[model samples]
Every structure is written in structure tokens, then in C-alpha cells.
Target chain A: MIRKGMIILVLVTLMAPCVFAQRVHIDIQAQSFKKFKIAMPAYTGQSDLAASLWSSCAKALRVSGVFDVLDPRGYITTAALAEIAPGTLKDWSLIGADYVVTGAASSSAGNVSMTFQVIDLSTSRKILNAQYTTQQGSAYRAVHAFVDALLESSLGIEPLFKTKIVAIREEEGRKQLYVCWPDGTGGQTIRGGGNLVLNPAWSPDGKKIAFVSYWRNNPDLYLLDVASNKVRLISGLQGINSAPSFDQTGNHIACTLSIDGRPELYLIDLATSGRVRLTDSWATDTSPSLCPGGNDLVFCSSRAGSPQIYHMEFSSKKVRRLTFEGGYNTEPACSPKGGLIAFTHLASDRQFHIALIRTDGSSMRVLPGSGRGDESPTFSPDGRLVAFASFDGDLYVSDLMGVAPVKITEGGGFQEPSWSNVMK
Target chain B: MKIGYRGFVVVLVVSVMFLVTGCAKKAVAPPEVEVTPPVVETPKVTTEMDMAEMVDPEVEARRILDQEMAEFENRDISFEFDKFNLTPEARKILAEKASFLNANPGVNILIEGHCDERGTREYNLALGDRRANSAKDYLVFLGIRPDRISTISYGKERPLDPASNEEAWAKNRRANFVILNK
Candidate 1:
């Protein structure tokens, strides 16, 4: 009996080291601006449908700027079923892949079902495994869902793939509003056939968009229900009624109304259609951006001789100037976390550049790689990226790190790009 | 007595020549007086005949308003870079505009505030509002009624010149006047 007990204890001691060896901890925060290497094998199913899903998933991941997607030719594991099963980490690790994604898709009677898994190549552990069913035409959505899940699992960060970007696109001397995916795909014009439409602001719920249109021969504010394509007039004040921004609750809006004989900030209650004047300055005050909590707002005011960003507290009714470095800074957009304010700064070179400043006015940094005439900088929902419009009218996305500025839109006259919150 | 009779005959011949010349002068004077009456009455007759064709005040006001609109459209008040405060030159132009408004009290004007493409759209719009209001306030101070003037800020949307240079920007940062009613 004593000899048998000694043998069993020795066996358990030997297995404990192997269990510890199989656990992989990928500290994504430590990677910072470095892209993680990932290998994605082709999904198995209806050949054409699987190929389409594979391409979309790969594109979404690549455009996210967090992954260095390896070419399929470098992937030695060609079988999707084999790659996703257990004990296949050695093959992917051999090719220097930190993470591996494999999926199988099937289509029947116009419905498509896909099963996908994200594996940690170092420890041979499956980090994510899920199945999604959708109409065959909506395969792209399913792939986006999977990519978002993989992102969350691998990086421990919220996914931005499900969010949309609203911007104004001009064509043939006409300006229109459009909504597109983050990757600049699936662009559809929501409204057009007007003299000019600009400054699209998305509601916090992502169901409505408020924009300025000259349809009535006046620059009036209009709200569009994105689902029904219905338009409603929000404010048609006697004078300039423009630059509408929704608060966090989505129940109140802050905009610039000239009804008081000067461009001033006014908060409009969506339920009662009542307005409360927030600013009464003789100088111009416009472009009110509400912080995440909706209790505070940052806007551009010309009270200090030139356009500069200012902060206003709701309860205290106190107004303070936030930006003073540049003689010209305007169109301030507060981040989702309410810690940073992004604005357009007119530099000494007489060119506009996108810049960031702390909400408390402690630090200021001009984001690198900003093009001339870059204005209307809006932060992504996660605050990881900032999308802005350039002078040539193309929309470009830049990381908060100020690197890898990718032009996401083509053609000209795309301005006022506003990122939407992640949709449920 | 013989010398006196010879002198009298000379006087009689001289008097006869004087009478003939006097009658000829009298004949020319009547014709001149006849011609002067028609020349003086011609303008009076036409003035009376065309009483209905005389300028109607409404039509005259409209004509003046049209002329003012055309003139002011070309006479936009310009400002320095990133400035909404009126310069001496801008104020002078506004004073002239105020006088025009005072003269044409029946006309209502819309002051369009504009800006160069040097700033953000929303800020430019606000700056434009300041510019238009600045002009309006000066007009009010100069005795133009506030109700007679309205203001709108076009920001950097409608530029006079789309070129991206100093000259074009200077032209773009201006306040334009448009006639809404007269």
C-alpha cells in the first residue's frame, strides 16, 4: 500500500507541470501599438459563400489596425476542421502565429450557419467558439459579429466593428448624408437632392441623425429616423439654426441658434420642444459637444477674440475657456470616456490640424499625420481612433497613437464624419 | 429864311428814312414774340398730358431697391483674418448702408454673414453671426430700425472665391446684403 501511494503522488506531480505549461496568458495591454500576429484559415462550407465570409472577416480584422494578418500562403494548416480542433497549435506556432481563427459555414435554403473559434496558438486553448445563423445575404454581418467577438476575447477590449460612421458626401455639386461601416463599405446615402446638407450628428441610440439642410432655402436643422427614412424638422429658427449635437441620454440636444440675434448655444428638450438658453455672449458660441455624462459640454466660442474651445457646466452654469494655445481652435468633440477633447487647430502654418487636449486643460498634443484642412475630428466609441475629414474631402481614420492614418473613403467632399456608438 | 427852308427839307427826308426803318423793326419784333409763346408752352403742355406716366412711388422704390441690391451684392464689407469686429473701413461702409436704409425705409434687408475657409464650419458660422450682428448693431446705432434688418450666417459654406489663397480668403470673409422686401 505504501509503494502504490508513492507512485500515484509522483504521477500527479509530473502532470502538474504539464497543466501549467498549457495555460497561455496574452497581455494585450502590454503589446500597446504593436500588431498581434494572427493566422486565419479558410472557412469550410458552401465553397463560394465560405470564400466570401473568409474575405470579409479577414478584411475587417486587417482594417482594425490591431492585428497583423498573415497571408493564407504562409498558413501550413489548410484544413479548417483540423486547424480548429485540439492539438493543432504546434502547426500555427511553427509559422509564428500568436492567434489562429478557424470557422465552418453551411448554407441551406437561403439561410447560412457559421461556427467559428479563436485559438491561442501558444497553449492550444480555444479562446472563443460560437455559432451564428443568418440569411445568406447577411453573411457579412455574421462575419463582423465573429470578428468583434474574437477582438474582445484576444485583446480584452470592446470591439468597434459593429459601429457605423455618418458623414456628408458631396457629388455633382450636391451634398448628401451617408452612413457606412467602419471599413468604408456599405455606404448608403440617407438623404440627398437638396441644395446643401452638412454636419451630421448621430443620436446616442444610433437610431436617428440630425443634420443641417438648405431644403427650405434656410439652413435649418432636420432629424432623420435612420430605420424608416422619415425626416422631421427639429429647429427652423428665424436665423441660423445649425450644428445639432445630442447628449448622452438622447433626450436633449444642444445646438447653435441665432434667434436671439447672435449665434449662441441653446439646449432643446426633445420631449417638450422647449429651449433653454445656455449662452448669452455677444460673441459667437457654437458647436456644443456634450460629454459622456451629459452634465457638461465643450464648445467653440469666439468670446476671447478668436474661436477657442470652452467648457460649460450645467448645474453651476459656469463657463470656462478650455483651449488657449492656438489662436484658432474649434469644432470640439468630447470623447466617449469624457477624458479628452479633440478639436481642429489652425497652426502657425495657416493649415488646420487635428489635436487633442485633456478635459481639465492639463495636456495638449497635436495628432501626427494630419493633412492640411483636416477638420471635424470625432473619436471612435472606444476612443482608440479618430476619424476626420481632409481638405480634399476624403475621410481618414487615425489612431490615438497618431500613426497609421488610413483614408477610409474615396471621391471628394466627405466631411463631418461622426462615429456612432456600438449597436446592439 | 432861305437856309431854314433848305434845312427843313433835309430834316423831312431824314425823318422819312427813320419812319421806314422803324416800321421794318416793328414787323420783326411781332414775329419774335409769336415764336417765344409756343417755345415756353411746349414743356408745360407735355407735363400736363403725361401726368399718369409720371413715376409711381412704389415702382420708384422698387427700382431703387433693385439698384441697391445689385450695388450692395457687389459691395460686400470685408474684414481682417479671424476678425468680426468692424474696421474703420468696414464701419464707413456700414454707415453708408445705414443711410441707404434710412432713405429707403420701406425696404427690408437680410445681412448674410460669411467667413473664409480658414476655420471650422461651426466656428465660421458663429463668426459670421458676429459679423452680421456687428453690421446690424452699427446700422441700428446709425438710426436704422432693427426690424428692417435680418441676419444669417453662412459660415464658410458659400465662398465668393473657392480658391485657397490669401486673396480669395480676404474676399470670402465678408458681410453681404440681400434685399428681402421693399
Candidate 2:
């Protein structure tokens, strides 16, 4: 018994390094790693509806960058609804699949119901079984909603495929504002350059936009009525004025003004034209965004030696410092849930990259670290998608919830992206 | 040593005599000087003229201003949208202006930084300030006195071109020279 114990101890000691290395890698969760491949079979319903459902799921998964989906039609020569229930592993493997899934969609009583199952092709065993239902007109949206659930259950991060990214593009030296899918697909310019436009921002309702323009040859705030395609000069106070962001209630805008001869944040009532001064420091204060609660704002100030993000409460007019780890952190955008705030952090390399800090100002991390200059990260309504202006001066979208980032626009100098609130 | 001390005493006596002479002369000046014109002989000797006579300052200043405006119009000193950094062309033009200013004394300038009508008014004002200051720094580096130059930014609030196009934007993104005090 003594001899056997000694041999077992030696074996265990030899394997300790491998175990340590595995654990070290496991917890960080592959910062930029790809997820597993998933094969989703054609959802069975009416022929046209099944094809629609399959296409929708495929689009979501492909954009999510989480799943390498296999074509369901590529295998199972004789497929029926029953075959989707118990498919042979040999046929799935022949089609080069590691995992297989089957789903069926049906409509009854004005609601669409979908049931799906995920199976491991190697073991030929079911891993996940779930059901989703939604009203008739929202069937397409229901598929995306379902995919978010599957991704969370399997990979632990919900996907943000349905989010929209807003960017300003200058074409022929004309500044135009546009909104597009996160993947850079389906973009439409909502406003054209009859005037110089900068710093486009979305309201909490996602129905209105606020931006700065020199249409009147002075800095003025303009609110864009998205539905009517009309713009109104919301704020035209004297002196230098720009950088406008809406509060959570959509009733007021926080902006920067130099009326007192130094740039500072001012809260303006869109209805009353009544203004409240937020900061009185000598340093320039610009790039203001409401804290997730709408009661406070985070802005850039050069007062603390260099430009840094500062927080101030609206009611008490108290101030606090937010970032200390970076040389300069500016252009702050508070996340929807207020879990994290994104801002442009200047790295030692002299390149600016978008970084995240916990709303309480801890756990600072730069995205795609060590290279790539990125800035202006705006979160989606779901708080999962981060659309930022690429340092190469283009627009790119990334998922804060584990979806791989993809550059959405090319060339023409796009910057300062603000993601729209989810359409209900 | 005797000569040094005696020379000092002599210098003092002469200075005292000169002071008395100066006081007497002041009292007798004007009417007395006119009365003595017949007895006094004026010497015909060459006198030094000041260096300022070599250049007419007003004309030179106007010339320099015209040159600056021409250079700016020729795309010599232009900036990207909302940028204050001096481009190489802008630097070259500014260098020429600085040389002209250095050549002419008593010519002070205000570097006015302007931006295209794009960007927030306040941000443009700051940017304009930076642009003007950047030009001032370059001029000072080239031997213009810092006291003779000052700067201000007109962030996107003022534009040389009112129309919204590349040509207009290019024209408006500029640093202009304004003679504030000469």
C-alpha cells in the first residue's frame, strides 16, 4: 500500500502544471476567442414560414459570431418532422457538423410558437430544449429573441445582433448623419449637410436626436424629429455651444457652453429655455452624458492636470472623479444599465482606444487591447452592443456581451457613434 | 597714479563747469540764440539717420497682410475640420508671414483661428483658439516676439465660406491674420 501511494503522488505532482495553466485560461473567458459551431436544422412549419425562420436564425447567429451553422438541407436525404427529432449521427457527421439543432414554427390564435432542440453530433444526444412564442407580426423578432436565449444558455453572453449604430459620414465634404445595422448593412442617411453637423446623439426614447451644427454660423443645438424628418433649433444661446445629450426622461439636454468664457456643462429645458450651470471649473468641460439614472452627468475636464472623466450629481451639484488609471479619458458614454461606462482612454502608445470602467470607476479594461485606436462607444438599448468610431476613422460595432466585433463602415471619416434605443 | 587722480579731479571740475554752462544756456536760449545767429558759425557735418527710414512701415504692413491673405487663399495654411494642428503648407505660409513680421518692427498681429461650420459652437471656439495659438507659436519660433502676437479660436461659428461643400469647408478651415495693434 505504501509503494502504491508513492507512485500515485508522483503521478499527481507531474500533472499539476497542466492543471494550473488550464485554470488560468478558463476564467478570463477567451477575451477575443470564437465560440462553438452550431448546426440549426430548417425549422419545420408551413414551407415558406420554415424557410423564413431558418434564414432569420442563420442571420442572427452569423452576425453574432458565436455559431458556425451547418446547412440542414445538406444532410438527411429523407427528412420529415420525425427525422428532426432523432437524426442519425452518421448523416450529420458526413455533413461536417459537431452539433445539430432542429426547430419548428407554427401559427395559431394570432401567436407564433417555436420549439427547438440542440444535439451534440458526437454523442448523438440532446443538449438543449426550449420553446418561444410571440404575436403574429413579431415572428421575425421572436426568432432573434430566441437566439439571444440560446446563446446565453450555451455561451453565457447574450448576443446583440438586432442593434442599430448611428454615424456621421462626410461625403464630398458634406456632413450627413446616418443609422445602420451593427453589421454595416442597411444604412440610411437621415440628415444631409445643409449645414455643418457634429456630435450626433440619441434620446432615451430613440425617437429623437440631438446634435450640434453651424447652420446659423454659431454653435446651436438641433433636435431631429426622426418620424417627421424635420429639425428644430432647440438651443441657440450665445457664445460657443455644442455636445448635447438627452437625459433619461427626454425632457432636457445636457450640453457644453462657453457663455461665461469657459466651456462648461449646462442643463437646458427643451420647453422653457431655462438653463442650469453644472460645472464652474476653469478647465474646459465638454462631452457630457447623463449617468444611467438621468440625475447626473459624466464629462471631460482638463482641471485635474489632464483631461479626465468627472461625475456630478444634478440635485446636490456635487462632483467626483471617475477615472484614474489612464493618462486621459474623455468622450464618456454611460452604459444603459449603468453597469459599465465606455470612454476613450489614451494609452501609452499615444493611441486612443475605447475602454470600459465599472460605473463606480473600477476594473478598467481596454477593448482589443495593445493596438487599434477606437473611441466613442455607445451601448445598444439592450446594453449588449457597443458601437464605436474606429480610430482608422471609420465606424465599427462590437458586442459587449461576447459577440465578435465587426467593422460596419469603411472610409469617409466616420466617428462618434450613438446606438439607438430598441424599437418596441 | 598722479595722472589718474588729477584726471578724475579735472573731469569733476569740467562736469561742474558744464552743468553751469548748461543752466546759463537754457536761460539764454530762444531769443538769445536768434540774436547770436550772425556771430555763430554752423558746421556742415554728416548726421546719422535712423534705420526705420529704410522702409515705410505702413506700406510694408499692408503688403504683408495682402501676402498672408493670398497665401491662405492659395491653400497655403488650411486645417482639417475641427483641427488646430498646423499642416506643412500652412506652416510654410506662416513661416513667410513670420519672416515679414520679423523684418518690420512695430507691427503686431492677432492670429484669428476660424473653423468650418461643422461642430459645436463652443467646441469650435476652443478649437479656433488652439488653431490661432498654434499659428502664434510658429511665428514666435521664427523670431516674432510673443508680445507682438496673440490668438483666438472662432470654433465653427465663423466661416469664410457659407455654402456647405468641400470648397467652402476648405476655405473656412483656416487661420487668418488680423493686425490688432501696430
Candidate 3:
């Protein structure tokens, strides 16, 4: 038995070179916002299941706005029949494909397993090879997981495909909060049966959502736990209690409260329910968005005679105005990186548009869009996309460099969209 | 002697006629003077009751309160574009309302602050709060009890007019009053 094992090991070592020679190397920097050309050849086993998984993976990558999936009709005829190893690299490179992803699936009993490899066509080197197993009906998730692995391996960034957007949808005059995948699928209503609901915000952990609803004839703040599907009222002050934003610590929430006869910013300790006033101005101050470190906050205030963005330090309570060019700049959403703020700016054309500015009050530019009421701008966790609601009540996602927005939500009456952080 | 007797009879008849006419004039003159005094005194008593019925204090208080509420509802104090400071006209209206509120100490009111649909909802909510409180502060300064007046902000959700034109926006950017109790 020892002699037989030694002979098998020698054979494996000889074959390993052939497998390594098959991979092509791909430069990581070649991947950009520009669509990367990817060729997805068919999987080896379970032809029908492999086809479906490949389609799902391609669709996910395409919807991510990162890949230009080549048409299958242009694929070399032998690309599908060829093995997933280096043998297929020649055919994919001939088609000018930058990257080639191939996989195989096998099912036994009630569980299914999938293995996929991402090959860099330029250097013939394998960049990613991952295997995942799931229940028979969860093949799509397995494929998505593989795609996420590929993205991370190539770009060194987390994939946003699995993230969800929580927004308010008004149906038949009753506003309900709904959560859906960023691609606008798998939507389910999370909260409803209120006179109106607005401003849904996601916590850093993505386990709880904070929003304002008019449940008891008054606008009250609520915290919804996504796991247990339970909601608890966070603030039900006598006056306007709305716009609850969770700080980075996840232990406190910053919200607007008018109980003192004027709407001002207040910080609520989530654990103790203790409240501390942040802004003590007779003028309007609300929509407090905490920066990444939770040490500073950017909000909209009317102290300058019109709604404009203002920055405030958490400890010293020192306030500085951040927006000046536009008189109607509001809804300040600080980026996760702590250097930029996205807001809704009312332009000279009397239309609301999405605009961005540096946190220090410099480098302001309006995102290009023709929508009249492009409002409530929220940044993606990576600060690459800005999701906002338009006049038609449709949620749109646009890049920071002002690309044409891609409409994510189909039906109307959708507003106050908040993108969740990367979910574990 | 006979001519003297005839002259005496004629003189006696003239004296008797004069005495009867004088007695009739004296009787009518006393009654005219007496009736004039009582007729003048009767209206003096009726005038007091008529004055009371015309202006009953409780009914007048309610009517005035109702009138003030109607005025408050119809005459919503408008602000300049994106402003909460009371305009001259707004202060004048608040002064008039303050007087009514002072007179009717048992009345309670609610100030509903509103804004145009131009700003963010949350910011507008704060602005509306400021607008409502501005009005309430003026009223309180004019001697109305602070507890008697409550404030609420509708933000830009509840607009007086839903149109997007300047006219509608000007009308919507206001602080309205609602009487809670009287």
C-alpha cells in the first residue's frame, strides 16, 4: 500500500505543472469602472444546472456595472466542451476576452456543490478558484458567492451585489417601507399601516433600521430589527420626531426633535435612552448625518436664511457652514470615507438635483440629471454610487462622476432611499 | 234805576263765563305736565334691559372667540421665502390674536407651522417648528400664557395649496392657528 501511494504522488506532481501552465495572468489595474470583458464558458457537469448558474452569475456581474459580458454566440465552438483547465485559455483569448470564468456543478442526495475558477487571459494564470456547496434549491446563491469571490480576488473590494436598499414606498396614499436587493429584485415590505413613513436609515451593522412613521397621529422614530422582525419606538416626542441616523458607534442615534419648540439635532444613547441636545438654535437644524468616525456631523440648517449644509464637531459643539453656492442645499449625506458629502441642491432652473462637495466646503459639482425632484441623496458604502429619489417617485442610482442614472425601483412613490452597509 | 240793574246783570254773566273757561284750562294743563314726567321715566328702565340683551357678556365672549378663530384660520400669517421671522403684518395679526386670547382666558390654541415643498422634508420640519414657535413667542410676549398655546410642524407634507407655482408656495409657507378649546 505504501508503494502504491508513492507512485500516485509522483503522478500528481508531474500533472501539477500542466495545470499551472494553463492559467493566464491578468493585471489587476486593468479593471476599472470601464466594463471588463469577461467570457463565461459553460460548466462541465450538470449541463442544465450549470447553464442556469452561469446566467445568474453573468447577470449579477453585469448589473454591478463592472463587466461587459461577451455574447455567447461569439464564443469559440469548442469553448464549452473544453476542460475548465488551461486547455480553454487559447479559445477565450482568441475572442479578445480579458477574463474567463468556468465552473462545474455536482449534486448528491439533497446537496449540490459548485467549483468555479477565474483565469486571467493575458498571463494564462488562474486568479481565483473557489468551491461552495448549498442546498439543491440554492444554486443561485452559490453562484453569486463565487462571483463575489471573483470580484474580491480581482479588484480587492467587497461586492455590492448582496447589499440591499431600504426605501419608503407610498401605496394608495399609505407610505410603507420596503427592502430589496440593489438590482430591484426580492422586494418585501418591512413596515406599513402608518399615515406616512419617511427617512429610512440603516445602522452600520445592518441589523437594525431607523425610520420615522406617523403611527399615533404624530411623527415618531422607530427602530426595526431585521433578524427578529420586531420594531421598537426610539423617540415619540411631543413635536416633530424624525430623521433618525445611527452614528458609527451603533450605540447612539442622531435625530431631529422639536419638543423644545424648535426642531434641533439631538443625540440619543441607544442603550440608556438618554438624550443630549446637539444644536441649540432657534433657526432650523435637522437631518444630522454623522461622519465616519462619529466625531463630526453634517446637517441642513436654515440659520443662513435658507437651507444649507453645516458641519458640527461632536465634542466641542463648534458649528461651521459647509455649503454656500446654493441657497437650497439640504439632505447632507456624509461619505463613509469622511471627505465628501452628497446632498440635494436646488439649482437655478428651480429643479432639485444631486450635488457633491468636499467636507471642508470646497469642490462642489452637481451630478448631471434632468429630473425635477432629484432629492434625498444617499451614498453607497464605498461612496461610488449615489442613490436618490426623483420627482416621479422612482429611485435611481448614479455614479459619483455623473453618469446617467440607472432606475432601480420600477413603481412610483418611492423616496428616502437608504443603502445598507456591506452585509455579512 | 233799571239801566243800572241791566248793566249789573250783563257784567255778572260775563264774569261767570270767564270763571268756567279758566277752570277748564287749569284742569287740562295739570294733566299734560304730570303725563310728560312718567312717559320720560318708562323708557329709561326699558333701555337698560335692551342693552343687556343686545350684548350678553358670555355670548359676546364666545362670538368674539369664534370670530378670532375664523380670522386665524382664514388669515394664516405668511413668511418671506424660507423665513420664520414674523412680518409686520404677521405681528399685527398676532397682536390681535393675543388680545383675544387674553380676553378669553379659558381658550387654548394650537399653532400649525407649515412650509413650501422646496426644501428637504426633515429640514422643512425644523423650519416649520421655528415658524410656529415664532408666532407662539410673539403671542406669549403679548401676555398670552405659554401653556395655552401649543405648536406643531407639518413640514412640507401638508400644504395649503399643492400647486408648485409661486402663488401656491407663498400661501403654503405660513403658520396657521387652530383653537383647541374655549
DockQ score of each predicted structure, in the order shown: 0.46, 0.06, 0.45
Regions of model 1 farther than 4 Å from truth: A1-33, A40-58, A70-96, A102-117, A126-139, A348-350, B1-68
Judge candidate 1 against the unseen true structure and give its global Cα lDDT, from 0 to 1: 0.80
RMSD of 1: 22.9
* TM-score of each candidate structure, all chains considered together: 0.77, 0.60, 0.72
lDDT of 2 by residue, B1-182 (tens): 99999999999999999999999988875753434445776976769776877888898988887776555335336898645678888888887787767766777766767887543333456666567767877888898988887555556545777886799999998888866543
Q: What TM-score does prediction 2 earn?
A: 0.60
Q: In model 2, how large is the Cα lDDT of residue A407?
A: 63
User: How does candidate 3 score on lDDT?
Assistant: 0.78
Q: TM-scores of the first chain across all predictions?
A: 0.82, 0.71, 0.80
lDDT of 1 by residue, B47-92 (tens): 3556766888999987977887687656889988878889999999
Query: Across residues A1-424, which tens digit of lDDT does each residue of candidate 2 receive?
Result: 2222111111001111111111112221335555556666666787787777777677666656556676555666535341344635666777777667677888788777766666666667665566667666556555655566555555555345345666776666666677765555446676543546778888877677788776775667788877666789877765456788888888999988766655788999988888988889867688888877777788887677667888888889888888998666788888877767888877766677777877778888777721456777777765655777765567766655423466667664676788877543
Stronger candidate by lDDT (2 vs 3):
3
Off by over 4 Å in 3: A1-33, A37-65, A68-97, A100-147, B1-75, B92-105
lDDT ranking from best candidate downward: 1, 3, 2
Worst 10 residues of 1 chain B by lDDT: B30-39
Which candidate leads the pack in TM-score?
Answer: 1
Which pairs of residues collide in candidate 2? A240-B122, A241-B122, B124-B155, B125-B155, B128-B153, B129-B153
